[model samples]
Target: DQQVKQNSPSLSVQEGRISILNCDYTNSMFDYFLWYKKYPAEGPTFLISISSIKDKNEDGRFTVFLNKSAKHLSLHIVPSQPGDSAVYFCAASDLSTSGTYKYIFGTGTRLKVLA
Candidate 1:
């Protein structure tokens, strides 16, 4: 069973439009969530995160919303630009796990911004 899943492998949007990415989890124990963005050949960089205790978190052009009851989450980026083209990964962790945080990542969604 996939604990974390990004059903859409890719998304394309024109510049200045809005882009939305979705993610789902099967494990109820996951309590912390994160979104990471990566460019080609580089490691993923943290974008935003939300704790199970909260429902939403935002940073600059990115926003993440979590529905704990539904075990679902999403990332939204407005005014998508060419520089936003990259692979986005959704990750989750059980912070209570042995008092350590280990990340479980989705396969990743590639976003392309059309200039």
Candidate 2:
């Protein structure tokens, strides 16, 4: 079974610092990983993603890293700000026999970036 897990329920970081969020999975069949941020009563917004073939991917202030051997991944935010405070979710997708894909998401980790 594919299971995505976020070990930390929350994290606090000072403004202008860095925030690191971790995630782990149990399925080798999974090939893609993504991170999302959500605000209260709103839909999640895509933050970043890394494919199984890539070890790391970066986009502006966000970075996503994947460790296929350990079935683990992480998201990093530099210069964390108060506006970055939100729920972060790690998600993995796998291609099925039907030629479609299924996504499994981890329990979100709430980040509070203090000023």
Candidate 3:
């Protein structure tokens, strides 16, 4: 049912380095955004997120920024660790589409942190 069915590209980073994940959406209507990290056999855990009205949001080692004019958003993970390895997902929803929240997810990108 998901639009993104292919295995996403992988990124490798050295431990203690910065890992940057990028997401670009086609729809300009997308208003809310979220970033999630999923480990094998486990549900995704929320990392960070931002709204269309806000340009940036940060939480601890994670930061997410939205560019409404460009229809793009990115996540930055600083001081990456081996335990940070996971599949990262970008999700977005538009309030105009429905009063309730219905998220459209991007094909996950796999991140591997090497020690």
Candidate 4:
């Protein structure tokens, strides 16, 4: 069972505005992270992520920040555009449990970029 959950079901932002998506987890053992974005009629695509050792990771217009103490994480999209509208999901891996990684996925947050 996954202890991860998306804090918001949806978000609306004006074009060129910043969009932030949030997620929370009950387990503190998660070490690896993965962020995925999904569009209509397609599988989720990898976005960005940050490991437990790191507080933040960024790539292009995407950035992920992890707060281990609060067991929370967030994704930031800069200059949000119409093309950036999609469902974003967060997944985490816990390797300390069995030496192998087990992935836990959270619900998705739909982001709508309004023109």
lDDT of 4 by residue, 1-115 (tens): 5599997989999999999999999887788888999999999998987889999999998989999999999999998999999999999888667466767788899999999
Candidate 1 structure lDDT: 0.95
Residue 43 deviation, candidate 4, in Å?
A: 0.7
> Considering lDDT, which of the candidate structures 3 and 4 is the better prediction for this target?
4
Q: Give the residue spans of candidate 3 off by over 4 A.
A: 1-8
How does each model score on lDDT?
Answer: 0.95, 0.91, 0.85, 0.89
Pick the lDDT winner. Answer: 1
State candidate 4's TM-score.
Answer: 0.93
Please identify model 1 stretches exceeding 4 Å from their true place.
none
- Candidate 3 has which clashing residue pairs, if any? none
TM value for model 1: 0.96
What tens-digit string does per-residue lDDT give for candidate 2 at 57-78? 9999998889999999999999
Give the better candidate number (1 or 3) by lDDT.
1
Enumerate residue pairs that collide in model 1.
none
lDDT value for candidate 2? 0.91
What are the per-residue Cα lDDT tens digits for candidate 3 across 1-115?
5432224478999999999888888777788899989999999988887988899999999999888887778889998999999999999889767688888888999999999
Tens digit per residue, CA lDDT, model 1, 23-56: 9999889999999999998999999999999998
Backbone atom clashes (below 3 Å) for every candidate: 0, 0, 0, 0
TM-score of each: 0.96, 0.94, 0.90, 0.93
Minimal lDDT window, size 10, model 3: 1-10
